[model samples]
Target: MAAVTSKVSLKLMIDTESRRVVYAEAGKDFVDFLFYIVALPVGTFIPLLNQEMVGSLGNIYDSFANLSTTYLRPNVNKDSLLSPKAYYCGATGLPLHVPNVESSRKVYRCCRNVTLDRNETCSCGATMNQESKYTVLPSANNPYSSEGDFVKGKVIYMVMDDLAVKPLSTVSIIALLNKFNVKEIGDLEEKVVDLGRDEVVKLLKASLLTKTILTDVFLSVLKEEVNCQQEVEGNF
Candidate 1:
């Protein structure tokens, strides 16, 4: 099932829709958005506004993810891989942990049939996947369309240090994970990439929508330099 992101996470989206005025992360309209406020009222109108709000929120999310890439590096296979094992609460059944694999800063040498890009493909067709270092168990392999070389009672361990060697961004890998139905386990999650406040301010200032969203605070807003529909309309 595809996960539906709550429009609650989107403050900027609410403003662009012009349905409710969002002065900060909280206002009378945004009160219930916190998910933990004791006295907040859940409005009858919020879900009704969801469709338009969703489309706009996606815009902010996408632009943030794209803008983030220039500042971050892709996780990779090699010395950059983590040394300690990363664990999951319940992978196939029991608690699981990827064994301590070798950590190297060296990128994986594509000496075989696998190209640089091909090595990145997971079984699910995601090219940005981490490698499973563990042996797949026979029973687990049996349930799926098998390569027919099934090992039993084990889980495939992903190379961990792949996350550490790169400048982790809040957006890219998480987006990829969502697309591929991948889950994070252990303390090594890419949850908080922590864009320095300066970085966040810089992005909010540079982003075109952000300029529109925060125009009052930023008097001298520079426009985003991009090819847009406005160009095609101008031609007409």
Candidate 2:
């Protein structure tokens, strides 16, 4: 069963120092903006943009001959073995956290035929196997097919440090957690430890889609970036 994001009341949040309109969400309109907000801070905006928006942005590769169509296509080649796989909540058919697991693996294995290393451990606290780490718990939003793409027997868990390491920025992660009704870092730490890495990732990422996070994040960004004084009526 997919988890549907809960609805939240409308409120404007402000970023006093930067004076930038960071969040501008209200009602269902705000829900559409969550992915955009996440992509901006992370600097992976191009991949997430829709074709209509991409078209308005102009040809990504106008100078390169015959490449306009190529850039306009979907972000990845679904059939390519090298294409990146996105994770999702097994219960909800939404894009979940895509952890940076490849970097955290202490030991990298090329194939199943490779000899095991006795002294290696993955970020998830398991002995490393195949060199790359991937999630197979059923993310409906994932472009790749789970059957052909993921290893059959590997134990998949959410990765904590990966996004933190992406240095997704302290504020963003906290904001995401807050939307999930997680109030403090200590609570999140315990939750991560209790739920294990994979579940935490799913929970946090999926939580972004929730009405609480969506509204909070939208208002938070607006408080930070949008010119609230002129655009909005009063103080947050």
Candidate 1: tens digits of C-alpha lDDT, residues 1-236: 01212222112211222222122221221121111111112221122233343336445433444564456455433221212121211122211111221112122222232222224533334453233233333464233211222123222212111111122244544643454344531212221111222322332233322323323322122122224556867899
Candidate 1 overall lDDT versus native: 0.27
In model 2, how many backbone clashes occur? 20
Encode model 2's per-residue lDDT on 75-112: one tens digit a residue: 33221211222222232222322332111212345324
Where does model 2 exceed 4 Å of error? 1-144, 147-211, 228-236
lDDT of each: 0.27, 0.32
Steric collisions counted per model: 11, 20
Worst 10 residues of 1 by lDDT: 156-165
Error of 1 at 69 (Å): 24
Best by TM-score: 2
How far does residue 183 in candidate 1 sit from its true spot (Å)? 48
